[model samples]
Target: MDATMENKMGLPPPYEPAAPNPAPPPSYFGDNPPPPPGFVAPPVAPRTTVITSATTRPGSTKLGPGPTGTTCATCNKSIVTRVEYVPNNRTHIVSAALCVLAGCCCGCIVPYCMRSCKTANHYCPQCKAFVGSHQPS
Candidate 1:
């Protein structure tokens, strides 16, 4: 009449303790076990390389005649400078004196028109900032 009596014949044999988990497998290291399979070591980060470079300071590098290449300080942009020539004061004075000595008033303007008698002013083409000047020696 009871449920236990009715199911006794269909039940599996009663449980028996499992052999104390078999002595764990031997490890290559003295006592530490190897990492479990499927464990990928954390990706080793690539070693960072330190690179040093020589830099030119704006003040240290003087601009030259023509379209000179340089970095602009105002805008901090690398560019080829646009050069504009203007008559040097010293050259003008000397030219005028030499012309008067030669007794020719029109000749005083000749040196002012010459490229070699002018000073070269360098400007950043991108920002139009004055970079430097090259005064003829």
Candidate 2:
């Protein structure tokens, strides 16, 4: 017999009218309804907070020698950490902009020797310093 005709579940025929569903009571559940007996709300856990410290020398100036905590390599005195940057092209750009603005040469922008030599796995021809791996120009 076909599945539908078999009443495969041994249930009454599918076309048999289901018993009329009785109308549900107007409100099955409501706020502030009295608990039947032993119902109780679970306690809530407190929220947690996390924080991290993220700070470095401002504008990427390397911490180095001289009288004050911040010192200029050229003057051998503390000019200010705000402008002086490590001897790179960027430092030159910054000093050049400063020269244009203030009309003075603040200091020489040192060429990046460490990277050029380290990349070649040889001593720096100019500085004569041994270059190490992992050093970036």
Candidate 3:
């Protein structure tokens, strides 16, 4: 019936620290580790490159819808290229959209006839070789 005995019985147990967590696997650290034993790395391959000289002939040049002056690769002559208009994807898409909206009227056909909507194909007037094509920007 002692108050000390009752207080002792009501007291909680003393604290004890729990064991520390085990070290995490190396993969979790995200550090670059050494290669495994007896691992043979493959030999590096040499890089190949192609270069065009300006003195010989200029590289690919972007052309416009109008005549462009460029050195032809086929004839190796410096001359103004003649442009020929060809209906490209942009022309077709615009035409299709116009056709859908205008009920297949002359509006859809406008893109096919317009010079702005089509791609310009450049040809060397000397050799008549296809130089390059300019897509509408």
lDDT of each: 0.79, 0.41, 0.83
TM-scores of the candidates are 0.54, 0.18, 0.57
Question: What is candidate 2's lDDT per residue for 1-137, written digit by digit as tens?
Answer: 66686686687654767678977776656766677788787899988998764343232343332111333333334343321122445545655676677666543222332233222222223333322222223
Best by lDDT: 3
Ranking of candidates on lDDT, top first: 3, 1, 2
Find the 10 residues in a row with the least total lDDT in model 1.
Answer: 53-62
Cα lDDT for residue 130, model 2? 28
Model 2 residue pairs with clashes:
115-137
Judge candidate 1 against the unseen true structure and give its global Cα lDDT, from 0 to 1.
0.79
Better of 2 and 3 by TM-score: 3
Misplaced by over 4 Å in model 3 are 1-59
Clashing pairs in 3: none
TM-score of model 3 vs. true structure:
0.57
Total backbone collisions, model 1: 0
